[model samples]
Target: MEVEIISEESIKPSSPTPHHLRTYNLSLLDYLVGYPYVPIVFYYPNHNDNDNNIFQALQRSLVLKKSLSETLTQFYPLAGTLKGDSIECNDVGANYVLVLVHGRLDGFLHKPDLGLINRFLPLEPSFDQSSVGSRVTNVKVNIFKCGGIAVGLCVSHKILDGAALYTFLKGWANMASKSEEVTYPKIISPLVFPAESLRLRDIFQVSYQTVLKEAALKVAASRNGVQQPTRVEVVSALLWKCTIAASKEAYGIQKTTWLNHSLNLRKKLPTKTSKDLIGNMMRVSSAVCKDNDETTLHSLVNKVHDSIVKVNDEFVNEAQGDEWYVAMHKLLQQMGEIGSVGPTEYYIFTSWCKMGFNDIDFGWGKPSWVSGLIGKGFKGFFNLVTLMDTKCGEGVEAWVTLDEEELKILQCNPELLAYASVDPSPLSNDHVI
Candidate 1:
């Protein structure tokens, strides 16, 4: 799909400020670092209709404002190590926040495009390697010739998670709509810091034997020695089935869900609890699969639901964690007793990209489109999925990636084919939302 930029604005600028040393809670650090900076892509399909005017309206609604350098402040306090020796400053503020108004577009354009999207993914920011502040530089607005608009948000994971960013965007939209004054978002930073008594070693335990054994056993059990797909593969299959079913049921055509998912290495360890953590500790993992058969939306959703649920089983989590930790530990030991070993497999997938962006509205209304790019780093599997509120109907929209072989299998299933043809209205309330 081709994108046209009707207008653009920067919410922050790239700059440094006097350092401010502030200790962050451990729980906040865990949540921040445990989550990856997965880009959110929102697509508003069929931009030609009156419904599509939301995009244009947003452009007119939002009041663009620039802040003083001192106004640039870090929302999440940095970890002590990252804040070492200097008071970190949040002098980085965007020049302006673009308000996008309008919401009519084909849903397909919002789906992930592995080829182009991967190139724009941000580099993982480091606490020690650089200053602790917003790393994101710009935002792009592209209007497609196909009557779709795609809004690309490039934000530093260090500055915000999916939830925070969405809140900001939604607030912006509400303001533009003249609904309410922008409300200050609740800062959950303090909640994620590490407990005073817990040391890094205690909180980030890295043991491999336990995780590996569990993974082996779970693989054996998934299909009675049929060789279970990797975590990426399982989620890819589930999403592909779910989206295809939803599309078929809503549009009467067998389609596919081709998107990516993000993973966080810090949280995947058997010892880690996602409750609270800081920093942008994450990686991207993706898989793609498609189905061509007719299928009810419920059936497709069930398939995706089941696949995701299965991979999170305790045995699966332990096995995946143990195997990953052991392998990394060995690699690190050989590298000369490294002080720290970052988890190689950052959890299996990211739901924030899929679920986090939908609620963002900057006064003009919900975004016509929201999406993110794949970041640079270790290479393996990556997927980015987003939960979209469809204009055609109501229900969650899932995008995923899969290989050709898997895609073929998904398309040929008769059960999936039938499931794709059902209506989504009756089943809309059944979804978790």
Candidate 2:
């Protein structure tokens, strides 16, 4: 698990950003994101024959840097620094580091240590100004002893969410592979959502990891006389239920809990093509379980489903207008009122399940595995769950962050264990690339 720094340099855009696009303003949605940085790693196994592997790895590394330079021209804002409320697209360049890992990639993935994943990235995913600073994007290319490579990317959450992040990755991969189907970023998110000044609160804690198999997803989605719940809904409901139960057990009494599921606002927008727009275009579908509420899995599923359904096209239209300001004010007001009503827990659930992270191939082949942060090696985050698609693309891997005591009780929950495997190896699936 020892990683050595092989090289470090900044990758500037091959072409200068147009003067008109120099200052990219932050959208209101971007300002609401709790974390300042988003980090992920893509593990690509060696595919070349033994003799050719070393040469191919070196050549591919050059291609990656070259293509990334070209890609940054289109994603110009990413190469800039975030200052105050806007990105100063002065072509300061992205932080790119090359590292050499001592062990084989396979051995590391066999029993992947969530705590050590941060080593792959240039910076930790936290809100600390000193650690994150003004850097808008950071990339680390990790070369393993077995010739496999792991590309770790850390982008400012102020600029992109899961959808936008995948868009950028796919575009970069397309350029690296010399594909004709080049993906271009549409940086119109700020024009659509506009920017506003606001302050947000922060929370801190540790994490736990679990993977919910597709079989469990099917069972959780089962219900009579109702439309099937999505894997996201079912998993979120189950985790919310289990965490609430854990909290009640750890403490002495039931406490009101709130679950917030983040929804991508691309498809709901007036322009369906906004799906390709790069920025934090998202909203939250919130549901609450009162102290005396029914905490059944089925009941929780319905609640989650209903809350999600409410954020449909019609709501999106209103959210795009004046209702947006009114809603923001109401949310701020509600946050203040909650403190006076005794103890309550809040959990934020975000899905990267169908974002196509596994398909980001850069000439060699698709990645064998992709990973998000498991909330280790940093602080200022808690009661958060990030659900990602498994390598096989059938199951959901939930990276949960909670307080120590609550997470301890949740680890031994029989119902949760029946439906999910805790921190399983990435190579457990036969279909991995």
Candidate 3:
């Protein structure tokens, strides 16, 4: 598909407030302090039919101008914190939000001209040398010539988790759609009711070490930093193909097993109000190897599903009430004396659709296509799945990055190659931006 590059500019930065952001009240404060950076992009597709114009869509989406910013300002301390020595909002002035506009011809091709998307993917936030909350950059809008638009937002994870972000986005969309008045999100502060506890040892008989090892092994076997695996390479060749094979063997073609991955804890929570939940409250549930002759997809998925259920049971048994919370505090105190720590590895699968970016309608309309840029630190042992809308065409568009050897394996996989060929869409060309 032919592509075009649009101009890049920074959005006006929000100012920061004085005072060190308090983490004591928020449960998810650790996330803020540890991995404060979050990149969010909104995709808007062109409206060939007479849907609402992009601006009208935004107007209908109430979260656009009021509730979102207000929510961010109200609960998320990171939103009000300064970047460097200055007292400006930590948001990097870069139009962290992107808008892409693509034409119907380009959209019909299905595959995104990589050249067009690449141009705007590598935006870095400009930090002030001297500021505290001053390092502010929030939303950015980028428009593509193909009539696709993307709103790129960079937020500090310290403040809001994926669930919180999604909730805010949904609220924004609902408001923008003018479908309802702003409803408050339910806030469940993990800090108020933390998850870990000492009684867990008594409640669940399973060994924590064993479970951690299993999860780590699965991730290690699937991904090694030496070689990365793009979502397409892994899903098409390993995940989906395995599912198909497993389904065929188990219950014939009539029965199929699908993978249902969960978003982070923040998104799944009830939203009457916002809370300061923190830590690795994220959970991911998926079917294991299905296509392999050794195991069926149903069995694999069932095993994982059962394991998750068991873990939840343990969580419920150990971390339920004020007594459990007290036990958890004691456990933390004891562990602190011995210098103990939490698990380092966990898995979660999420799609861009949850971020509300996929449906962002700017003045021009929706984006013909969209994608997440793979940044640094994502290599080796990390399994992050991103989703994008299929440009108007025969098949969908997916972008992934894997290690060299994995790439070779995927290229040689007949099942995967066959699947790729099934889609008549054109392959991506090398155009950045």
Candidate 4:
């Protein structure tokens, strides 16, 4: 199916921002993000067919547009320009695009083509032209021939994270569906991770961009034992094992790989800090492993879970000091030192399981699937984005990145294939006509 861009416009805030809120300060945590624009897609299944269907669809679009403007008023910094270390909230507006597809959304949903998804997105999510250097966001409303819709949004990592994106999106949907009032987000990243002492750009330095061999791994949620394995616990354990196995087999050497998993700190923050406070509120906890035995699954899961559990309020609060920056800089130095030795690699795991993606109702309906633009960077791609099936409440989806050879080896693993199939979407089916 071919996707066509029908129209494009700017969606500005419905009201002018107060002069007091004109300049949005960038936090030290925001500076460390390095401006990677994360692209996410939401597929809403709509099969309405009636005389008023077309008119109703147009009405929904108009409603979404209006609510978006109102929602922008709450997140006014998004509609502004990034200048130096701050966002100039001058109401420059965000890009809004309307797209059309040649076929029904059923086929697309049944078999999602990631390459084709770029057509639905408003802009490319890349780090070259950083969001700080260009636009903060680009949103697209895709209307399929089947009357279904796909909402594509690309958010800059410089000012926002997954939590921020979810908050903004859910707020927009609430307004569109229930005409609810939008709450002003409590932006306090600077207070938590003050930029006064730790200048991320100045302290952190990388001499060479090392291209080490990497692999993506996955595991489904399990319920065999007394305790059902959470998505992050299961996925992290399996992926960590797979990374070790793939690295050793690919290079024919024994090496240790560092496994760093991100844990959200909103819940861990103090009540006064507030969960509603926006910005990148995530901390990374890491573990190193050289063992290749698959029998250690339970131990690895326990390790990852313990690492995540250890990120309590005290841990998050203490991490805001200079020691944290020194630790990160040393970690990078260690990574570089390790990479220079052999086929060893560093893998970062981010699990969006139990993310309440299915709860984001946008009047039409909840999206059948929500996906992140991960692994698009093929060269040395080392991160894993794990998603959950909100309806089933137990399924896990992992998009892993490995070189062609390593991927072929991973595909042959009978152990992994026994429980779950490898990228078995409808796109790979022969029945598609």
Best by TM-score: 2
Task: Give the per-residue lDDT digits (tens) of candidate 2, residues 1-433.
Answer: 7888878999999999989989999887887787877788999878554866545666778899999999999999999988877888989888999887888787788888888887887777777742324879899999887788899999998899999999999999999999999797899888887765554534423367788865555565565413678888888888999998999999978888888888998988877578789999888887888888988888888889888998888756555577877876776577557635877888888999889998999988899888888675477778889999997887888888888888889999998887888888888864222
**CA shift of 102, model 4, Å:** 0.8
| Best-to-worst TM-score order | 2, 4, 3, 1
Worst 10 residues of 4 by lDDT: 204-213
Off by over 4 Å in 3: 1-36, 48-78, 82-109, 114-118, 121-137, 145-148, 174-179, 186-263, 266-280, 284-299, 313-370, 375-383, 387-400, 417-433
Give lDDT per model, in order.
0.36, 0.82, 0.38, 0.65
**Native-vs-model 4 lDDT?**
0.65
- Error (Å) of candidate 3 at residue 77 is 3.8
Per-residue C-alpha lDDT of model 3 across residues 201-237, encoded as one tens digit per residue: 1100000000011122234325422133333223323
Model 1 per-residue lDDT tens digits across residues 55-159: 553443233222211113333222112332222334334423333323323544333334554322223222333344433333444444333445555444444
Ranking by lDDT: 2, 4, 3, 1
Tens-digit per-residue lDDT, 1-433, candidate 4: 7777777998899999999999888887776664356677888767676566445656777888898898889888888776778888888788899877778777876756666766667776544556354667678988876677888887777678777777788788888887454555777777877765555531100000001111222222232321555656766676666656665677786576766776777787766545567787777777666435343666667667766776667766566776777777876787677667655656666656666766788787777767666455333334443444434454456666555566666656665554445554522322111
Candidate 2 Cα outliers beyond 4 Å, as residue runs = 49-55, 130-133, 197-206, 224-226, 335-339, 430-433
Cα deviation of 190, candidate 1, in Å: 4.0
Cα error, residue 164 of model 1, in Å, equals 2.8
TM-score of each model, in listed order: 0.46, 0.94, 0.52, 0.85
Which 10 successive residues of model 2 have the least lDDT summed?
197-206
- Give the clash count for each candidate: 110, 1, 110, 0
Residue pairs in clash, model 2: 204-381
The alpha-carbon lDDT assigned to residue 354 of candidate 2 equals 88
